[model samples]
Target chain A: MTSANSARRRKPFPVHILVFLAPAFIIYTLFMIYPLLDSLRLSLYAPDVNRQEVFVGLDNYERLMTNDLWQPRIEGAIKNNLVFFAIHMLVQNPIGLMLAALLSSQFIRGRAIYRTLIFTPTVLSVVLVGFIWRMILSPLWGISTDFLDLFGLAAYDKPWLGLEETALPTLSLISVWQWVGIPMMLFLAALISIPDELIEAARVDGATAWGVFWRIRFRLIMPTVGIVGVLTFVGNFNAFDLIYTTQKATAGPNYSTDILGTFFYRTFFGVQLQPGNPTMGATVAGVMFLIILAGVLLYMFGWQRRMLQVEF
Target chain B: MKKLLALAVILTLVVALVPATTQAQDKVTLTIESWRNDDIAFWNDVLIPAFNAHYPDIEVIFAPAAPTEYNAALNAKLEGGTAGDLITCRPFDLSLEHFNNGYLVSLNDLPGMEHFGPVARSAWITDDGSDVFCVPMASVIHGFIYNQSIFEELGLEEPATEPEFLELLDAIKADGTYAPLSMGTVDLWEAATMGYQNIGPNYWKGEEGRLGLIDGTIGYDENGFVEAFEALARWTPYLPDGYQAISYPDSQNLFTLGMAAIFPAGSWEIGVFRGQDPDFEMGAFKPPVPEGADTCYISDHVDIAMGVNAASQHQEEAMLFMEWMTTQEFAELYSNALPGFFTLSDHAITLEDPLAQEFLSWRDECESTIRSSYQILSRGEPNNETQLWEVSAQVLNGELTPQEAADIVQSGLEAWYEPQQQ
Candidate 1:
């Protein structure tokens, strides 16, 4: 009878559970949720002639989409962001997967050393990476040109970072080089988590090594792949530091390297001769937030549904 | 016993509060914000000490931001109501914008302003020429700095006309020993500063042309600007191959290393050039005009000016510092520290540096006019400085003709102006 009474008392509302969740909830609300909501609120206002913020109610967003000075830049940034994401998905992820596969293999020697060397760039500051790459690629110094001349490919050498056609792709590739380590490490962990006995079973049943990898290992790592894809998408869309450090706040050579991150920065802070408008900047941020939210929802609902958790 | 304890606490509070209030009254710190990060040492060692020598009760702090990031940071600080006591003021639109937004304090009744001449005073004055918003610091003259050794080696003289200048560039190019011009358009502003701002005035015919532009009586597609664009295009061939990939610092490196013959820059760069190569003998020449023009007009304008922040807690102290800054003593020190920067004071501060003397000579010899750099005269809508840089870079890259570039600028100006009219 005493036990039944204790059970019916509802465990005193689980004070310990509340205690555990409180810190994280407070932090998340203070840092992330408050700022996000503030930005959304700010998007509804515009600066008047006196530079005082006044509530304009959707005018900023409408102007951002329709204004001559802003519309093209927004569209261009969105397009560049897609290209940036596509490059990572196609090039960075595949290379990471291949490297992970090789490094995780039992036959490969010095796998640990290779892993350490590859991940070194990921730990370096983005500013340092951008500056170092800019110096190495500078045509004035002739470092890149000299390097290319050694293989008799001097004709192919140009100011890749300065040219309008090549600047964005070149920057994207540099970003890929720095970040490929993240996906590689994730894939390597996923690969290691798979029981070796399953592979052995597949091989013993007359399956080749490639077939074992294709049918067994790849199938087991779909969940990790989905996570990596979503992470890459989010990171690519939110990218700013690298482009800003390299090309400056203008994102120029005629704004070829412009992405949503740079666009948002320029709108918020202004660059060169462009004066900042906080209202428009907040509007841009709100749009970006919505886009990212949609992407996250799609991943959770559609991709997560198909991703089966592999049991050991 | 409780009453006794409360009395003890009250006595302790009184003792603490008295000294705190006295200390606050005895000393004040005035913060000065500027974009001249390179001049921190000068401010720390020289200016601060000089200012403190007079007003020992007030301490001065020199806060600096990089030139590229200065405006944005300053705007943020102003918006947050936390800007410094004294603020550096850019000429024209930026200053006007800040004034309109009530970020600056009017200095119409400030002392030492009488020392400023008509030109220096007019720079900070309102459009109606009644109120002054800032105290003028120094006027910088823009021209080409050439390697004296290279000119001696090549037996070249400072050209006095546009044709002569082009001829000199041609000769230098034909020599093939060094780049004729050390200019990097990669930063985009280099071309605008070197070619447009320095040389454009000579083509535009100075103040008359600028006034016409401001009043909408003239356009960028007019004959003067077209000629200026042509002159800029003419200099492109003398630039090094892959010049667009070379940054401003790299271009300076080339000039200092003797890889280039000429560098077009403002007088503010004299100290920089000297620091890079102490023994590097360089000579200055004002941008030459067409042979039949009235006179070669040199680009002269106040480069660094200071104003008191309206929201500052120490307005009286800031005004004191600014008044001290405008004195002849400060002028001499400033000119001594940065050789070629001419003081705004009508008082004759003797020039020690040969380069400063030469620039002074140029000023005396030609019709010196206020520099009408794109932002200096615009309505702040077209952002013509940025447009000029972009179009100038395109011209250098051979992607656009001078005419096409002129048309682009004209269209931008029209787009900005049409809306204002409506």
Candidate 2:
């Protein structure tokens, strides 16, 4: 009787646990896990000249890395994708942090209104944002020129969205404008969660506002920073909409704005008269997965492992 | 009282359903799946009524998806056996893919197939030319569309030669009353579709060059292609200020708003132009031939067509409608209703839109060719169509010399194209 009781106690299995997990597990498996595994499997094979799916393990990767036709495009897309991520990290995160810092301050006026106004673009459809921005920046009919003229900067105005050098960076800024609210809200939540005693103790030590932010608040929110960084990395690497909307699938002006997502799309669905190659597309997707996986793993193992989460 | 009311309700229900059940049997309904959603009103109000005039029993429904989503959506519907009987065919490999996959049936034995010549049917034919899958509906001609008032204001005449064309643009730019060219590279296709393909045929010698490319006798780096790029390069100076940032719609607005003079355009823009500004006087001129060239070339590319879905239950009714499409009445109706979309039928229907008529008149005055890249060359990596857009844009942007642009396309083609390998 004791053994039976102990066995039951040790098991600690509640049948309700599975009952609770069943719906989510089944849905995630069907939608996410299955497609991901299948796509990974597809990367290992390609259609032969006779259109038969034949095992050609690592050949697609080899070609993607080395073939004259594909290598440059892959390299270009990766390079552009890195630039895209860098822009987010360098510009978006810092601005978001600043906004959160400002909004959290006791001196700021109408903080709620400012927060709502800043966050308004985040809820707008990406397509609508792209369309509206395209019109606003249009050289022929755009009001951007007039806006610049008001600042005595009319001569500096160029088709920032149209040029090869400017297209990606300009798009990055536009994306930043649309998505800044996410990181801002995240940082705000993190700031609010910080225990008041720690901050009050720092204030008692006569720490300046800047010193408090850098030494106390920023250090305590390191975990959130890591999360936001990983999220931005994953999001920016997979981004397609704004670029696809603005530059098209070609990633035009000599493919200055081509990212892995657009590249994968063009490969999978083809563009113009070029027929889609599913196997090759899967290979591109496989590379993208590797890129995002590496970033995530680095965050989890490298960054998060070292981040000291402050206890209340 | 309850029994009497129940009985009365049953009788009325039977009466209502009686006609519906009978009508469902003898009346065959045909749906045409098309990307031309803009023409739904025309199809319903004008073309369908005309089609109904001959076969009153056959009911036609004009079902369409957004142009960009049509291909994927149609394929999905086809896979599920729920597609329309008649499918609007995108030209070249896209339709050819359908036939190969058995989504579209061979229309080789259709009686009306005789009405189309090989050129009109080329877009839908099999690789070995054994089967024609779609009936060609229309082809859009590429040319220069200009504001008639702007031309008059500048005292400019339609140029017949490349030198004269440049001179006219120079005159307009000098006057500074309007932007000389209202085109942009932001939408890369405009550079290729309206610019390179529009004028490339002149330098490449039309069908001779196109057939040569198909036959593996021509190289993109050759004089013809390079010269076309050179001509495209010269167009940069006259383009609208800050042209690089301009998009297709922006360029259209510029032209329509009378801030720009000339728009390199496909004939399909006629309806759009008219729709936007009913009183806007527009004139189209054929792509000017280079100096000392006796034969002028124009791109009269097949744009759209209709095919029978192999899985559709009502193939007979669909074929009947397709047959009627080849008739003179349908041709006249289609051409008049959709002014810019000229019918592929042999019937020489008069166009009411002067700009559209002007575009059609080029067929008589010049040699006609499809976009050189569309048929087969675009099937592989470094797609000719896409490459043309990028290279043409780069060349116009002065980022690449014409020679470099030509070389890029040639080498890119050589990478995969078996013929270009040599």
Which candidate has the top score in DockQ?
A: 2
Residue lDDT tens for model 1, B1-422: 23336545544544564444335656897778799898899999998998889989998878787887577567767876667789998876677668768999889888988888766765676776777888888888888899999999999999988889999999999999999998977687877777777888888887777667767777788878888888898888999767866778888988889989998888878888988888999998888888788688887767778999999888899999989978989998888888878887766677888887788677667766675544344455446776788888878767779999999887777776653232
TM-score of each: 0.88, 0.92
List runs of model 2 lying over 4 Å from the truth: A1-12, A309-312, B1-31, B56-61, B76-85, B101-115, B309-320
Candidate 1 versus truth, CA RMSD in Å, comes to 6.2
TM-score between model 1 and native: 0.88
CAPRI class of candidate 2: medium
lDDT of 2 by residue, A78-124 (tens): 99999999999999999999999999888989999999999999999
Please compute the TM-score of chain B alone for each predicted structure, in the order given: 0.85, 0.92
Please state how well chain A of candidate 2 matches the true chain A, as a TM-score.
0.95
Error of 2 at B21 (Å): 11
lDDT of 1 by residue, A1-312 (tens): 999998979667878988999999999998789889999999999878777899999898888889877788889999999999999999999999999999999999999999999999999999999988889988777588889999999889888787778889999999999999999999999999998899999989999989988899988999889999999989988999999988887676777889999999988876565666778889999989988888989999988877755544
Instruction: Please give the lDDT score at residue B161 for candidate 1.
Output: 89
